[model samples]
Target: MKSISRATIGLTSSVSVLGVVLLAVLVYCCIHFWQAKQQEETANRALHAVEHLLLKPTSEYSPEDVKHGLEEVLGGQGRTQARVVDSRGNRMFGPEVFFNGEGSIREFSQVFETELPQLQAKRVELAVSTVDDERFLNFISGIFASSIVLWILVSVLISMRLIRLVLRPINRLTERIHNLGPRSLDVVLDDHKAPLELRPFIDGFNRLLGQLRENREQLKLFNSNVAHELNTPLSSLTISHELLQRRKLIEGEDLQKIVGDHLDELDRMARIIRSMLFLANANQGRKLQLQPVPSLRQLVVSVAEYLEQLAEDRDLRITVKSDATVEAETELIKRAVSNLLSNAIRYAQANTEITVHITLEAERVWIKVSNEGPTIDPLKLNRLFEPFFRAEEGRSDTGSNHGLGLAIVAAIAKLHGGDVFASSENQVTVIGFSIQTKRQSASG
Candidate 1:
C-alpha cells in the first residue's frame, strides 16, 4: 500500500480529467478530416473521367464506340458508372442509368460537338458511387485507439511529475511534525504557508496545545498548595507531641485540651484528603449512582435542618424555597447542599436570613443559596470554587472548612453533568449549581 498526499491526489485527478477531454476532441477532429479527404478524392476522380470522354471527336468514334471506351475506363472501378447521349436521344456512352442507392454520388456532365460530320453536341455524364468503406473506418478507429493509449501513457508520466511537485510542501510539513518533541510543546505550525484547507485543523491543534499547557500549570500550583495546606497541621502536631513528651508534670485540663486539639487537626487533614480524592474522581469522569428525589424542596429542607444549629450561632435564620425534583446520588446531593448552606451561614450578617432557593425546570434542577454578607470582589468570584481558595484572604476563622466546601460542591455538580456558579452584588452573595434532570418539560 503506497501512501499518497492530498496535493498529489488533487493534481493527478485534474491532469487525468483534462487528458480525457483532449483525447475525445482529438478523436472527433481526426474522424472529420478523414471523411472529408475521402469525399474530395471521389469528386476529383469523377471530374477527370468526364473530361477524358468529352475530348474525343464524334466524327472518328460512334456513340457505341465511345460507350465501350467509357466502360473499359470507368466501369472497372466498382462503384463508378457513365452515360453519353446525343441530340437524337441516342445512348452514347455506358448505361443511361443513374446510381439509385443510399450512398455518396458525384455527377459531372461535359458537352462536346461532332467535328467535320453531323456536328451535333453530345453530353456525357459521369456518376461515381461512394459506398460505406469498412477498411477506411477501421483505419480511423485504429488511429483513434492508438492515440488514446499514447495519450494515457504521456498523461501518466506528466501527472507523476506534477504530483511530486505539488506534494513538496506537504512532505516538508510531515518532516516538521516528525521533528517536534516535548521541548517544542509550545511551538505551533506556521499556518501562513499552509494550504487553505489545512489552516482550520492547524488552528484547532494550536488551541488544544494551549489548553494542555494551562492544565499543566494548574496541576503544578495545585501540588504546591496541597503541600502547604498539609504541612501546617503536621508541624503543629509534632510540636504539641514533643511538648507533651518533655513535660514532667502537666495540668490535667491542659493535657486533655492538647489531645483534643491534636484530634481536631487530624480530623481536618482527613477531611481535606477526602475532598481532594472526591475531586480527583470527578475530574476523571466517574459517574455517581443517582437516586430519584420526589421533591428537591424536601431534600433542601432536610439538609437545612442539620445546619440550623450553626446558623443560629451567628444569629442567622435558614430558609428554604424549592420547586424542583432531582435524580442524583442522595449522599452527594446532600453534601453539595450542605457545603453551600454552610458557606452561606458562615458569611451571612447576623440576624439575616439565608435563602436556599430551588427551581425545577423541564430539563434541569437548580439549587441556589443566597445570603447577606460582605460583598465578594467580582474579580475573585469565578475562582471561589477552586480548592484551597478562600475569599477571606487567609483568615484563620475558616476553621475545619479548609476551603474545600465550595470545591466539593463544584465536583459533585460536575459529576452530575452540571456546573457551579457564583455571583455577588451589593453585599448579597449567591452561589448555586444546576443539574440535568431525567425528565424534561415541553419547552425544554
Candidate 2:
C-alpha cells in the first residue's frame, strides 16, 4: 500500500481549514461591498436627475414638469422612491414616505437651492430608497464561489510542494533502513545532515543497531557452545558402541559398566536439551499457569529436600527460614526453587550452612539463598545469571554443573513478573529473586 508522509497530512489538513476560513471572510466582505455599491449607484442616479431638472431654464420647464421627471426616474423601480421639498420644508413633489414596516429600509436624502434667471430661487430636498439586494446577493455569491475554487486549487498545489520539501530527508532515511541488514552494523546515519526533528530518532536507531549486532555475536557463541556440549557426549557414546561391536564375545560386569556409562552421557545430554527448551519457552513470553500456593516456606522445603543429598555430599547443611505464601505456577516455581538449591549446594563451603530466606511483602515474595564461600568478584557477579556463564570463583565441576541452573532461575523469575539479583561480600554470597503474588499479577 502507498503511504503518505506526516508532513503531507499535516499541511493538507491545515490548508483545508485555512481555505474554509478565508472563503467565509471573503464571501462576507463581497456581500457587504456589493450591497453598498448598489445603494450608492441608485442614490447618485436620483440626485443627478434632480440637478438636471433644476438646471433647465424656468421658461423651458416649470416646477410641475421637473416634479414629473423625478417621478419617472425613481418610481419606475418598485424598491426606490424619491421626494422633493422646498426651502420652507413644505412638500413640493412626490408622495410622503415613512418607514412603518417590520423589515429594514435604506434611504438617502439631500437638500439644495437652485436659482433661475426668470424665476425666484427655490430650494429642494431630495430623497430616494434603494434597499432591494437580490441581484447584489446573487453577484456576490458567484464571485465568492469562484474565489473559493481558485483558493482550493492554489492551496493544493502549494501544499504538495511544501510537503515534498519537508519529507525529502525522511524518504532518504527510509531508503537507508530498507538497505540495512546484520552485516551492515557499521553503517551510521548522518545526524548533522538530517533534519533537527529526526536527529534523536536517528541516534536511537543507531543504538538499536549496535545492540542487535551484539546479540547476533552472542547467539553465534551460544550455538557453538551448544554444539560442542552435545558433541562430547555423542562422541563418548559412539566410542562405547564401537567397542561393544568389536568385542561381541565379551559379557558380565564390564559390559554393564559400559552400558551405565552410556546412560550417564545420555542423561547429561537430556538435561542440557531440557534446560534449552525451558529457556526458549521463557523467551517467547508464554503465559504461566499462575495460582496461589499455600506456603512459600513449604515450596522451599520441598526443593531443599530434593537437593539434601547433594548438599550433604558437599558437607553442607540446608536450612530454610520462610513463613510466607506466594502465587506462582506450581511446576515452574518448583523448578526455579530446585535450581537455586542445587546451585547453592554446588558452591557452598564444606560444613557451611546454606540458608533459604523468604521475605514476603504486600505484593510479592522474595526467596534468597545465602552461603559462605570465597567472595565472588563484583564485576563477574553481573554475568552470573547469563546462560553458560560460570564464574571462576564459584563451583568448577564441569561434569555436573552445566552453567544453566542460574539462567533457568532467572527466566522463571522474569516469567513471574520479577527479576534476579546477586551480591557477594565479607566471604558470603547471596543469590535469589522475587515473584509477584497473584494480586500484583492481576493488577499488572
Candidate 3:
C-alpha cells in the first residue's frame, strides 16, 4: 500500500540536474581564471621589455636626446602619448596633450610661474588604457543569459525523461489494481519488462495476493462441502432414531443394528473433519521437517500388513518389490501408499489381483500400486489428484469417501519433492510414487 509522491520524484530529478550544471560551471570558472592569469603575466613581461630597451644609457646621448628617444619609443609602441614639461608646467617637447576631464580640480594662481616638480608630472603621462566599453559588457552578459536559458531547458528535459522512466511501471500497476476485483489471482507480472530493482517487490505482492485469493475460495468450498457431507449422515441418524422411537420392539438385534449404523455415520463425520483440518494446515504452509527415512522395502511390507484385511475381503493380492531403501518419513509415505491402495481397491473388480511393488533403479525409488481394474478414462486421469474430484458417481456411492485422500497424498508428495502419476494400459491401471536416492560418496 506504500506509494511515492509525484512531487518528490520531480524534485529529486531537478536537484540531480542542478548538481551537474553547477559542476560544469565550476570547470568553466577554473579555465577562465587560468587564462586571465596567463594573459596578465604576458602583458607585464612585454611592458618591462619595452621600458628596458628604450632607457639603456649610451655615451653619445644627452639628457634631452634620451627623453626624445623614450618619447619616440612610446609613440612607436602606441604606449601612451608622451611629452616633456618645463618648470612652468608647460609643454617643452613632443606633441601637445590635454587633460579633458578633471576630478577634484585644484585652484591655481594663473598658470604656474614655477610649478612644484610633482605638478609638472602631468606632461609626462604614458599610455592611457582605453576605457572598457559598456556595449562589450552587455554582450558578455548576453552569453551568460543564454547559458542560463539552456540550463533550464536541459534540466526540464532530464526531469521529464526520469519521470517517464519511473512512472510508467507504477502506472501499469495502478491500472492493474483498478482492474482487479477479488479475482486477480491469475494475473502474472512480466518480470522481463519490469525494472530490476522493483522486480522483487512486484513478485512478492503478486504472490501474497494470489495466496489470499486462493484461501478465500478454498474456505468457501470447504464450508459448502462439509455441510453437504455431514447433512446426509445426520439425516440418516435422525430417521433411524425416529423409527426406533415409533416402534415398540426396540430391545432386539434390529435395534442394535440401527445404533451401529448411527455410530458409523458419526465416524465418517470425524474422518472428514480430520482431513479438512490437515488440508487447512497444509494450505497455510505448515512445514514438516524431515530426517532420513526407513528402507522402502520395509515401509511397503508394513503397509501391506496394515491393509491386509481389506485386500482379503475383496480377494485382492498385495505385493511389494524393492531393491533399495527410500529416504522418506515413515508415517507420510505410509499415508500416501495407503491412499493409492484405497483408491485402487475402490475401482478394482471383485476377486481381482492388486499388486503393490517397490523398486530401486537408476538412483530412484519407485513404489507402484497397480490393480486389475477397467482402464481409467484418459481425460479424467490428470484431475484425479485434485481435491473433491471423484472419478464417477458409481465409484463413490458405497465407499462414501469425502474425496480428500488422494489430495492429501499429492500434498505430501510435493512436500517431499516427489510426484505421483496414474497411467493405464490393457484394462489395468497403475498409480505410483518416486523419490530421489541419496547420492553415493567417493569413498563408497
Using lDDT, give the best candidate's number: 2
In Å, residue 232's CA in model 3 sits off its true spot by: 2.0
Off by over 4 Å in 1: 6-70, 78-190, 248-255, 360-362, 438-444
Stretches of candidate 3 off by over 4 Å are: 1-16, 19-27, 30-34, 37-176, 183-224, 350-353, 357-365, 395-397, 434-444
lDDT of 2: 0.77
What does the lDDT read for residue 375 in candidate 3?
A: 81
lDDT of 1 by residue, 337-392 (tens): 99999889888999999988777656777889999989999888978988878888
**Residue 50 CA displacement from its true place in model 2, Å:** 12
Instruction: Give one digit per residue, the lDDT tens place, for model 2 in 13-87.
Output: 577858676867777777778777877787777777776777776778776775566567545245555666665
> Could you give the C-alpha RMSD of every candidate to the true structure, in order shown?
7.8, 7.7, 9.5
Supply the global lDDT for candidate 3: 0.66
Q: Pick the candidate with the highest TM-score.
A: 2
Ranking by TM-score: 2, 1, 3
Please state the error at residue 132 of candidate 1 in Å. 13
Identify the runs in model 2 with alpha carbons over 4 angstroms from their true place: 6-147, 393-396, 438-444
The lowest-lDDT stretch of 10 consecutive residues in candidate 2 is 117-126
Hey, what RMSD does candidate 3 come out at? Answer: 9.5
